[model samples]
Target: MNNFRFLVDPVFSKRFGIAPFIGPKRFRPPALNINDLPDDLDTILISHNHMDHLDYPSVKQLNKRYGERLTWFCGRGTRQWFLDNHVKNVIELDWWEEYHFSKKEVNIAFCPAQHWSRRTAFDTNKSLWGGFAVWDTTHKFYFAGDTGYTHNISIFRQIGKKYGPFNLSAIPIGVYEPRYMMETQHVSPDEAVQIHIDVQSKKSIGIHWGTWALANEYFMEPPEKLSQAVKNNQLHPSSFIVVKHGEIVDLP
Candidate 1:
């Protein structure tokens, strides 16, 4: 399955900005470069419109190269970004909505994620923000795109009841230090572990960390914190994994 590629939130850049002082500068670069992408990429799942998630240049380049062969799925109101770029096959989905690809035998459902979206000041929260539940005959995976720990625990519980007990999940685990500022939008490591339980995932991996130091916490602190959180929650070492950049795992 080396040629089978599906990219999620692929941002390969030095900063999250469209113009000067628009967003924070990236502390590090993406592990995978856009040019390194496989020629026969299957699909692209975009979660939101943040510069880090919905990169304009990357999208433009991919569309220019792959065109209609690449299918783009994103949050409800995020369709315009790609349409404006002249992308041919863009699918926008609302929360709890499902899209089926019969040929690929895959189903993708948009799910609730407690977060906000904004690429510019006037467009704050104008677009939808959420996670995705992707499933096929053999695997069920949840991608909690970008979210915060909120009172809406039922959102995940509902996901668990509706489409979960997932085989694997990708949850955010960093850029959440100094809770006062980030509590409304980012989930901490402990909260990420809670999400794993909430979603009833058999195995999960910590993401949204290591690539960029966007918060006050030290760059190397997330993995250590994730380890402690798992231990404190009495979870097995393999239940929630911390993978190195560019590392490959053979999912069973």
Candidate 2:
């Protein structure tokens, strides 16, 4: 099986730019400028239509550079946005649907997440929003795009029982604030730990923190709180890691 590595979110460089908000350090997202990515990248899986995850400029930049070399897999709601922006090679799927990249031995399936979607006021939930489960011959990876604590976690665990025991999971652990307001959509660090345990993943990496000031918590609170939660739960530190921007950690 081929190895897996995440080139974390790449952001454009500029003051008050969108890059610094998603990752911990203040650096450009990553230099995947279309032409720089591996020729066999084969697929680009997007979690949702959020600015951080579905970056228009970055996607456009990649489209310009790669032409038809890459295929974009996004939510049903995001298809029109991409089409409006002139992005080709796009395949949109609904939750629970599966797409297979036969040549790569990769099977990507859309899964439910408790979240809303909107690019503009008129487009709320216009597109389906959710996370993804990427399974191949050697490994299973779960990318929880953006979500709140919901029964979806239990559903995902059932999915794991049938198709998982994920080798690695990339889950969000930020943007939660003012519990009452954020609780319905964004999960706190403690919730994230529950997700990690529920999914029964061998290793879990945190994301969606230190990026945008989407909530009331201080900039560094997600990781700090996440660490404390892990310790309190007596979970191994290596089981729940917080990666820095532009940093890559290999799955076990």
Candidate 3:
């Protein structure tokens, strides 16, 4: 899932002045705005510093409302930003590191992803980038942050061998266009399906598309492409789902 409302100015308005690409206008408003978030929010999981994944205003608002009560978990080299922003109780983990929350009886492990990071030119790859595997007693979930079809896709096999056969997976299936340039950063729909199989997920959901016109494809193209790929591979339709903006799926 992508959330970028609080970053309207920096991401959409190009508050820093446009150099190359600016103003990634969204197709529709977010289903839940920052104010609409639940007060019961206890922990925040940040994948990286990208504006779409980690919004400054949103984090500030959450910290303002929750304070030390909120525990933040993020990738390596990203903790300083939270500290600089006055948010305490931050835990940053390198790939394959795990953290357990006794109170919640859940464990979260940072996993591998073929992706890079950058908020500004000088900060490229200054921080780590990866996905996460979260598990409770009976359920294991994978959140594939943002990835590409790297030759080292064997990383998924490692994930599957360790924490996978995932009960559910949220995989990015969009923002891939002009393959020459994007192939190294984003996964096309076909590649996403491979990730689903690679991770051994019982069910997978397609995300990262239809929210913003981040690539050359139309807003509705990802799901259609995914459907075709699934059919071509003879995979069941229900194996991977494309949910609507405000929809919720009841997991077993």
State every prediction's TM-score relative to the real structure: 0.93, 0.87, 0.89
141-220, model 3: which lDDT tens digit per residue? 88888888766547887888899899989888999997888898899999999888888999999988886666887778
Q: Against the true structure, whose lDDT is highest?
A: 1
Prediction 2 TM-score vs. true:
0.87
Candidate 2 ranges beyond 4 A from true positions:
1-36, 151-153
Which one is best on TM-score?
Answer: 1
Clashing pairs in 3: none
Candidate 2: the clashing residue pairs are 10-29, 10-30, 11-29, 21-211, 21-212, 22-211, 77-127
Model 2 root mean square deviation, Cα atoms? 3.6
Comparison by lDDT, 1 against 2, better one: 1
Q: How would you encode candidate 1's per-residue C-alpha lDDT over 1-252 as one tens digit per residue?
A: 223358888776566677535667776666677678888888899999988888887787788888899999999888987887899799999999999876577888999888989877788998899999988877789999999976645587888889989998999998998999998789999999998999999999999986665789987888899999999999998999988778887777
CA RMSD of all predictions: 2.0, 3.6, 4.5
TM-score of 1: 0.93
- Candidate 2 on 1-252: residue-level lDDT in tens? 274322333444322234535433432344234555765556677777766567766777777777676678888878778788888788899989998877676888888888888776677888888888888887888888888888534765765675568888888998899999999888999999988887778899998887555689986889999999899899998899898765668654
